[model samples]
Target chain A: MQLQYDIEGGNFTKAGFASSEIKKVLKQLNVDAATIKRIVVSSYEAEVNIVAHAYKGAVTVVIDHEKIVMQYQDEGPGIPDIEQAMVAGYSTASPEVREMGFGAGMGLPNIHKNADDLLIESEVNKGTLVTITIYLKQEGGQ
Target chain B: MQITELAKLTEAQVRCGNGLMHTEILYAAASDLMSDVLTIHHDGMVLLTGLANMQTIRTAEMSDIHCVVLLRNKKATPEMVELAAEHNIILLESPFTMFKACGVLFNAGVQSVY
Candidate 1:
């Protein structure tokens, strides 16, 4: 199955809407509980990132029998140094965003922790694209 | 701890999900940072936070948290209450600060989501 959602920048109210919907889909598909939790956390963090930093963004999800792939593409001020941004305490969020209980620099790290594989590509002054994959079934189905 | 027990410990008001007061919580974490909350791995945890916003409820929903205790007498917006109700997440308001709320729960044998 495939699904796509548009993310509006600065819309904190709707930041996790897409993730919540996809979470329901995953549940309906009978994805394992642990894997579903990981996917939800990773996607929610990615969704929030777009809301915190991007001008606009889109999330594309493709779920197969074996794995779920989520791609987040956003148009905004791209990360100048992906490596630096991956640090646990690195963030560029404005004061207002921080006041809302985000921008602690744990977003990417949380995604990294939950995703089996992650790829991030960005062009300064342009935008960013983040792709995350999580296996629907663990090895040995444990 | 049961949601009602938690409410009693913190002297909290059930802003929503009154019917869910019997729900049991295994662990708890206190944080104003949604990012930090997302990193928590515990299931069936209650979130104690001072930040009252839609994102707070959103974070709890995404994290599978069934209850949120708003500390410092913070009032949740109508939108947040509606979202909590929709998600079936119980919302509690407490006059205690975040630290005090967490401490009260911890003293009552609620494990920390560390």
Candidate 2:
């Protein structure tokens, strides 16, 4: 099953809707709890990034019996330094963003930790694409 | 401790998921910082924070937090309430300051995640 969500930038209130729906879908599908958690974490991190950093974006979720994949694409300022942004404590979010309980520099790192496979591609002054995959326990071959 | 007890102790308003208030919370962590909450790894704890936002609910859902209590008289937005409800998380609002709210919960047997 695949699901897509359009995220409006600067709309903090609507940020996590995609993740929540994904979680529900995963639960109804009866996936492993651990696998569900990984997907949820990754989806959430991506969703927040879309709301915080992007001008606007969409989140795509693909759930298979063996693994789950998530893709986040955004048209934004584009990260100038992927290496710096990957650091655990680096964040470009302003104080206003931090005030809402995010932008703590953990989004990307958390996404990386929770997903079995992570990929990020960005073009300066253009946009970004982040893809994450979490393999199911039954699919240990992953 | 149960979420019901924590709500009563903190004098928090149960905004949603009242039925789930019976859920047991084994630990508690109070922080407005998402990074701080992320560091704590309690599977079924109650999160107490003054920050009321969609990300707060998202953090709790990802971390397996059983419920959230917004302290310091902060009101949760409608979107936040809807998000918490969808996650099956109990959302509560308390007029007590963060410090006092944490103290009350601690006094009533809530322990930090660490």
Candidate 3:
């Protein structure tokens, strides 16, 4: 199955909608609970990153029998230093965004920790693309 | 601990999920940062935070945290309440500060999600 969602910049209210919807889909598919948790964490962080940083973005989720892939592409002030942004305590969020208890610079790292494979691509003046993949089959699968 | 017991310990008022008051909670963590909350991997945890925004509810929802205790008398907005209800998350408001709230729950035998 495939799903897509549009993310609006500066819209914190609707930030987790996509993650929540995809979580429902995963649950309906009877995906492993642990796998679903990891996917939700990574996807929700990516979703919040777009709402917190990008001008506009979309999340595409492709679920197959063996794995799930999620791609988030956003148009905004792309990261000049992806490595720096990956650091846990580095962030460029506005003060207002910080007041919301986010912008602690943990989003990227959280995504990295939860995703089985993660790829981030960006341009200084353009946008960022983040792709994350999670294998559905666990080592102890039934 | 039961959600009702935690509420009693903190003198919190149930904002929603009254039916879930009897749900068992194995651990508790207090943080104003939703990012820190996301790092927690424990299921059936209660989040004690001063940040009563929609993101708090959303973070708990994503983390499978079923209960939240708002500190310093912080009240959740209608949007947050609605979202919590949708996610079947219990929201409680307490007059205690974050430290006091967590301390109280800990003293009452709620394990910390460390």
Candidate 4:
């Protein structure tokens, strides 16, 4: 199954709607609870990032028997330093965003922790694309 | 603790999932940052924070969090209320500040730190 959603920039209120819907679909598919949770977390963080920082973006969710994939593409101020952005405590969000209790700098790190495989590509003046995958099979278990 | 007790303790109004007040919660986490909430390991937890928005409800849904306690007299959108209702998650509003609310709950045997 594949689902796509346009994330509205500067809309803090609607940040996670896409991921919320995808979570519902995953639940209906009877995916393992843990896997569903991980997907929701990673996808939501990515979605929030786009809405908070990007000029605009779209998120794609793809689910298969073996894995779930979420791709986030945004036409926004690209990350000037991917390595710096990936750090757990680094954030470029303004004070306004911090007032809302976000911009704690955990978005990318949390996404990486939840997804089984993660990749990101960006251009400083253009945009960013993030692809994250999570496998159905749990670690160290049959 | 029972959700009903939590509601009474915080002087909260239930906007949805009244039936779920019977649900028990073992731990609580208070944060407006969705990323922080996602980092902590919580199963059957209650989230107490001043942040009331659509994403807040969505975050609770994703984490399997059973209850949301909005502190400092914060308000939630109609859409947020509707979504929480649909998901069967308990929603409560409290006049207490975030610190006071969490402190009250903790004093009443609501375990924190998870």
Candidate 5:
């Protein structure tokens, strides 16, 4: 199954809705509870990043018998240095986002921890695209 | 501890999830940072924090956190209340500060998620 959602920037209220919807779809697919949790966490953090930093964004999620993939693309100030952004304590969030109890800079790290495979692409003046992949099979158990 | 017990121990008002009071909570952690809360996949956990916003509820929903105890009398926005109810996650407002709230719950036999 493939699902897509639009995310509005500067709108914290609507931020996690996409991931929540994805969670429901995953649940219906009978994905295990543990894998569902990882997808939710990984997708949610990526979704919030767009809401916090982008002008707008969209998420594409693909699920099948073997793995689930969530791809988030945003139109906003893209990351200049993905490495710096990956650092745990690094943050460039606005004061407003900080006040809401986010922007501690652990978002990407959390996603990294939860996802079996992650990829990011960005352009400084354009936007960013984040892809997260997690396998459904329990054999290799992450 | 039961969800009601966290409210009782911290002198909190159940702003939502009245039906959830019977749910058992086995672990907890306090933090105002939603990212921190999202770091772990929690089960049977009650999150204690001063942060009350739409993202807090969203964070709990994503992390599988069962309850959120807002410390220092922070107010949960209407959007938060609505979302919490929809997700079946409990929203709580405790009169005690974060330190006191965690301490009180700890003394009452609630295990920390550390």
Candidate 6:
């Protein structure tokens, strides 16, 4: 199954709708609870990043019996230094955004932790693309 | 611990999900940063956060958290309450600060995810 969603930047209230839907879909697909939790949390953090930093974005999720792949592409001020952005305490967000209890610089690192494979490509002023992949079933194992 | 008992320990008011007061809570996480909260996965967990916003509640929903206790006397917005109710998550408000509320709950045997 493939699912797509458009995300509005700076809209905290609507931020998690995509993640919630992904969780429900995974649940209905009989994905293990632990796996679903990982996917949902990763997706939530990614979704929040776009809402916190981008003007707008889109998420595409593809699910097969063996794995799930999620791509988050946003049109906004993209990361200048992907390496620095991955640091646990590096953030460029404003004080207002930080006051909302985000932009602690833990987002990308946390997403990396939960995802089996994480890919990020960005431009300085154009946009960013973050792809997260997780195995729905163990590789070479029952 | 029962959510009601945790509320009592923290001197909290149930802003919503009153029917969920009977829900049993096994673990607690206290943080204003929803990113950190989402990183931990625990069964029967309740989030104790000072951040009173829609995103915090959404964090709870994504993490499959059963309850959210807003500390430091922070009020839950109407939208937050409505969303929590929709998600069947117990929403609470405590007059105590994050440290005090967490200390109280910890003293009462509510384990932390860390």
lDDT of 6 by residue, A1-142 (tens): 9999999998877989999899888878888778888899999999999999999999999998789999999999999999999999899988877877888899999999999999999997899999999999442334
| Native interface contacts kept by each candidate, as a fraction | 0.92, 0.67, 0.79, 0.74, 0.97, 0.82
Q: Which rank order by TM-score, best down to worst?
A: 3, 1, 5, 6, 4, 2
- Can you give the TM-score per candidate against the true fold? 0.96, 0.90, 0.97, 0.93, 0.95, 0.94
Ranking by DockQ: 5, 1, 3, 6, 4, 2
Question: Please, what are the lDDT tens digits per residue for candidate 3 over residues A67-130?
Answer: 9999999999999999999999899999878888889999999999999999999997799999
Rate residue A57 of model 6 by lDDT: 100
Compared with the true structure, what per-residue lDDT tens digits does model 1 show for residues A18-130? 99999999888877777888999999999999999999999999999889999999999999999999999999999988998899999998899999999999999899999
In candidate 1, which residue ranges exceed 4 Å CA deviation?
A138-142
Candidate 6: deviation at residue B22, Å?
2.4
* Of 4 and 5, the candidate ranking higher by lDDT: 5
Clashing pairs in 1: none
lDDT of 1 by residue, B1-114 (tens): 789999999999999999999998999988888888988878889999999999999999888899999999999989999999998999999999887887778888999766
Query: Taking the candidates in order, what DockQ does each have?
Result: 0.89, 0.61, 0.87, 0.67, 0.91, 0.79
Which run of 10 residues does model 6 chain B get worst, by summed lDDT? B32-41
Per residue, candidate 2 scores C-alpha lDDT tens digits across A88-110 of 98999987788888888988888
Tens-digit lDDT track of model 5 for B4-110:
87888899999899998999998988998888888866588999998878888998998888899888988888888999999999999988998898788888888
| Of 1 and 5, the candidate ranking higher by lDDT | 1
Q: Which ten residues in a row are the worst by lDDT in model 5 chain A?
A: A133-142
Which of candidates 1 and 4 is the stronger one according to lDDT?
Answer: 1
Best by TM-score: 3
| Residue pairs in clash, model 3 | none
lDDT of candidate 3 over B10-108, digit per residue (tens):
999999999989999989998999988888899879999999899999999999999999999898899999999999999999999988887787888
Tell how far residue A139 is off in model 1, in angstroms.
Answer: 14
